[model samples]
Target: MSGDSTESDVAQETTDDDGPKTHSTSFKIARALFGGVLAFTALDNFRKLDEMIAFADSEGAPAAERSVPAISGSLLFGGLGIAAWKLPRLAAGAVATFFVAITPVMHDFWSRDDDEEKEQHAIHFLKNAALLGGALAFLRVAQDD
Candidate 1:
């Protein structure tokens, strides 16, 4: 019958249309770039490990706690980078969260009195914060779809 032919055509059209697929090429590249940046940061942290430890001690870090942040940061940044390469938005968000939590504590602006030094530090902080913000923004945009 004509009705049966129309129903069959509808069924064939429905079968041709597949469900949503979730691969974003832009997101993948963003993730890899963010991951690479994190990896580089981790490398820089390791390169200045002893200086970091000394600063931690000078700032009254407990002997037991002094090495912990350094060790954790080195590992975390490095690991997050690799993870981001595989899972960009999630990894970027995770890394940014850690940075957001620790940056102020580690670089306490309230304690510094020198204007030039403060300005220099503030500029660097803002730059880093902007980078983190961009990573988070990318994550959000990628997730929205």
Candidate 2:
């Protein structure tokens, strides 16, 4: 009889409340938006591979031509995984790695002599860094879950 009572209490505690479930809906939308950015960027990269490769070559990353496909594919699938809340940690880690690896290579502000170029590169570098931080935060949240 005591065990039955305890089970009933547990079930009651787990029951859903009558309040709006907006928090969950908002989280889902946020996740999809986050992943959408990555996926869209990946698609853009694929669509303009030649132009991207040319830009990379101009930036002294000639090998980017060979690597763009793999990078774009990672972003596409990783973003999808994140949006779907499936293997989010892994997806976030991959996105984070992409940002970290590309930041220095693509946004080498220190290597630029022109002030305008330097400032532009610096902005891009910092933006990527901030994105990396967001990805790390996502990973931490996923781990907490």
Which regions of candidate 1 are displaced past 4 Å?
A: 1-29, 59-84, 141-145
lDDT of 2 by residue, 1-145 (tens): 5455475554444343743222367667877888888889888999999998888778886478787677778888768877887888899888888887778989999999999999999999999898788778766656544
The TM-score values for the models, in the order shown, are 0.59, 0.79
Give the C-alpha miss distance for residue 124 in model 1, angstroms.
Answer: 2.3
lDDT score for candidate 2 against the true structure: 0.78
- TM-score of model number 1: 0.59
Clashing pairs in 1: none
Q: lDDT score, residue 130, model 2?
A: 87
